[model samples]
Target: MKMKKKSATLLTTGMALTLALAGCGNGSNNNNAASSAPASGSASAPASSQAASTGNGGSAVEITFWNMFGGGEGDFVDQIIKGFNDSQKEVVVKQLRLESNEYYAKLGTALSSGKGPDVAVAHVDRISPFVKAKQIVPVDDLASKVGLDLSQITASNLQSVTYDGKPYAVPLDTHFHMFYYNKDLLKKADLLNEDGTPKLGEMTPEGFEKTLAQIQSKVPDIQALAVNTPYFQEPFLNLYYEAGGDILNADMTKAAINNDKALSVLKFYMDVYKNKYADLNDKNPWDSFSNGKAAFWFGGVWEAGVLLGDASKNIGAMPLPPIFGSQTHWASSHLLVVPSYVSAEKQEASAKFMKYFSEVGGSTWGKAGHVPANANVTASDEYKSLPYRDQFIEAQKTVKFAPQTDKYTTIVTTIAESLQNIIFGSESPEDGLKDMEKQINEVLDN
Candidate 1:
């Protein structure tokens, strides 16, 4: 949990190592950065794979659960699987860690070859291809037979996992972005109330900018914020949506990058970097965040994990501040999903264990830095007990999700690269957005 400040040299090494692994599908070994995509908001053609195998139910209803998270996260998933298997009389869950970065590629190969796990972890957009292929079964009936209602899950998260019309997975946690402020620094700056808690909701972009000016004057070594290009993407999208920018047309046939509202959001974000409100050049924002230098940053839950123990002393989070709308946060979820290749017997078993897996996995998953969406766990004493829970949970409720498509992963890189160029002084917001629209349309056309 002791995250070292990734120096230029260390970053070079890590990037070289991780980029090599990227060919194998991982962008980062860090789970918070590991994964996501959206449904096109339109229907695709029927699947090619046959559904409803007619036969007696298999005697062995062992379900295989494939996970990409390792280290503490992997251990936590294992514990959940162990608990489910030990507590249940009929279903057995087999949990496996696929070390390769090529998670989806390998998964695609496996499912097509009829060798994929019964319950493999796939992101929202990632499930589109599988769902269209009809490799996975619909869970409307599965949930009914087991008495687990899909209504319990957040509507957006549920919709992301649902293809044409059926639930394919249960979203586990919402990884929304929140603003982490240094409590000690806030107190030092006399921003705290008589009650001693820092007044965060009042900290608007302008108000926070003034605070940063004071922090800069007093703590010369600290940065106002550390800008991670990708971390800022969702917040920018949130701002775009608030400012009236749609990411794509309702049909998902055209990109909305050229819209005035989207361009406005992009310009505002680039201005943050250009105006010296944040240090944009750092390869890792958390380093600037953890070292007592960054005043505020929009970071994911994994930021909490790497800052476990002593590192947590200086950092605390508030919901993302609203720049353009009533909505004030941006988030994505880690969903618990079933694969197309999973046996019907295993799907039946998985349904029975969904809530339980969510409960047992909740505390640990949260401790690993995500906010659990499991109704049981979120209501539990442990979740309410966390310091940032109240604020973060509210933020999670309004988190935004990408348009889901089988091609989401492939499409994201174009947007990511375009964003990097705009943030790093390589392109203008207008130019960058133009590039984004072009690249996005190219993907849609394909």
Candidate 2:
């Protein structure tokens, strides 16, 4: 039910891997305006008021922002909301920190009560449910107002937030996957070229196996791979894609667990983590990698964000090694939104503040280890020049996203569990998946 970081150094080091930031804008709170329309029917529409002002007959537009981020990510968010507060503020964004587990339950309760954050941070995966519930507004209005083109965001990442033909939320950034191998070990094992990085293009699942075999033969105590949850399961989809298995038919109503391609992926994992081709019995694979034991791992740009602390002195990165014909990174993004409950006055003020957040705050977020979707901000001299951006951007070009469906929570929860069984020896890959198909398809049937 919970995802855990690996136990080894490379894995444990990833314990800090998070995709959050201090947030958007100048992070300053100043001028306050009255609500766009008073809810009580007698409030005046001041030229300058709080960003929370809404035109509910002149009531303050109070929006609660529910988020799973609470790191430098929180600080980043604070800055942006503060700016919205400072701008000719009619809309007020009040942010509430929710543990990853508590986020949805709280959101559900709020929505049912008509008291939810006007603009809560909803994931692409969570979009369908909110759409079905009518809790959020289609962002097209705001995007048009600001001259922001949704096409500017990565299509794959954007796909997640789109529902029933309309885009519900804004695309944030690609928190995509990567495969990190120990440069030092690969070199010692003669797996690297003269440049010290492995010949990644040639790093197939078979090749990945051979390289790990080499490491295992030479270093008996060290595991050659790590199987961090959720992240560990991510590669399977790409591998399945490579193996030629379509997760669902166009209808999104059926499971293709029976596909031979997906099965091969499971078998591959069995060899690496369960069948014993390499030693992978660790609590955290990334830790094994960072500690210099595990040779290859599947992680993401967000994973590297955690390493932002002592990056220069600590580690290295690479695109995910080839398991399929071409490289496909797994990723996600974050966005800033204006909810429908806010009045037109607050919407205008919130939009202005959001613009500032998108501009200045975007780059600040990049500093906290996230790639910003704000083009002007992301392309600035500082962002493009940062060492982290230079290395991580390579993966953004080919990243793929998990299908964002209202049922994603149920889907991921079941799949992650079944995948654990396949990797940890509780069941055979094929056997586990056949059973998994039944369970997943049931959700779709509902």
Candidate 3:
């Protein structure tokens, strides 16, 4: 269940090209990026005209789909595609599985050039630029045409894709970090409760640290907590969001991360490292937790398949504690979008695929460890039966999605790079905050 790492180089050069070409206007085919091969089991037939119909023995409308899913998630997608194809004859969805690191760049190029997959996957945070550039079409009318009930989608997930009072995409799943504890290690440290949950002293940050200290005292050999230092942004955002911090000002006109809340969160991580509560140098912290070398971890819900499915691991997951203030934490979603350049018929077909993905395929997607955006799927008895799904649902309720600014990609990347320097002592927290604020404000201004 390894997800692809975000490539900074691709994001910078690729998205820059996307925005530049978008500024030149749509329906251009000047870019020459190579197209990827279709996934196994997808149709290879040429796309049908907009007037084509699937009724009365008409040709099935062929539409190209693009996504970055791999490993276990990829398997689930393959199953979903097969189910959709077998269950009907109205539409045929051909898929192109792109390398995640290069996905956005290639997608940007495709959209700008008016050539590529008719439908594609976009992160909630990454779509702001696309929507602003009009590279993707609004899906509300298309969903309605396909008999997809938009009201059945999770409210928060739906809200995330809405721009200018219109839904630009159909959200598929909300993915975020959850609190995972090694039950066997907790039991050995006398921190496991009677019902197999961790027993904490209090809900405050200090109280949480004291618990970590106690774990160190009882089981000094293992890391009390495994902080994700490689992708430091997730852990940092989880706590900063809990502290009610914002990345931008009210109108999104400037930076807003230099306040006390952020400083306190950064200091908290510094203390965790200083006290040896977590190893600052554990590069593969997720593996450390998975291999039973860490007592606790803040891991993504997507990892549930490997961590929770195996009873031998003795893992128990719960919503992150309200240590800073509230349950709010960082979250992002995978959404289905139709490029604005797609034909109306293909847009309708894409909506049907989205409906199936949200309705019928959601349970299978849930098995891949994401909280399905379709409320009906989450409410199903089958979905409720999965391990720790209740906790996953609860955690999603308070998720703080990235701000809806076109500058988000640049801003977040800046934050990630600066935070790493701060955590590694390359700069003091105070100086780092000042520098990060300046950097973000510059991005916003541009």
lDDT, each prediction: 0.66, 0.62, 0.90
TM-score, each model? 0.79, 0.78, 0.89
| Predicted candidate 1 versus true structure: per-residue lDDT over 202-282, tens digit per residue | 434555556666766666666666666555565566667656566678778888768777776776666666767666777
For residues 1-446, write the lDDT of model 2, one tens digit per residue.
13443346556555544311222222321111121112111222232223334433345455445577786777877876776655533455565666666666666655554544445565555666767777766776776786666666556655667777777777666576666666666666676777655754345678767767777776656666656644556767757655556655666788766767777778787777654544445666666666666666666566565543455323456666657666664556776555555566545544544555556667777776667766666668888776557667776766666665678788877887888887777888778889789899998899
Q: Residues 224-297, candidate 3, lDDT per residue (tens digit)?
A: 99999999989999999999999998899999999899999999999999999999999999999999999999
lDDT of 2 at 253: 80
Stronger candidate by lDDT (1 vs 3)? 3
Error of 3 at 431 (Å): 0.6
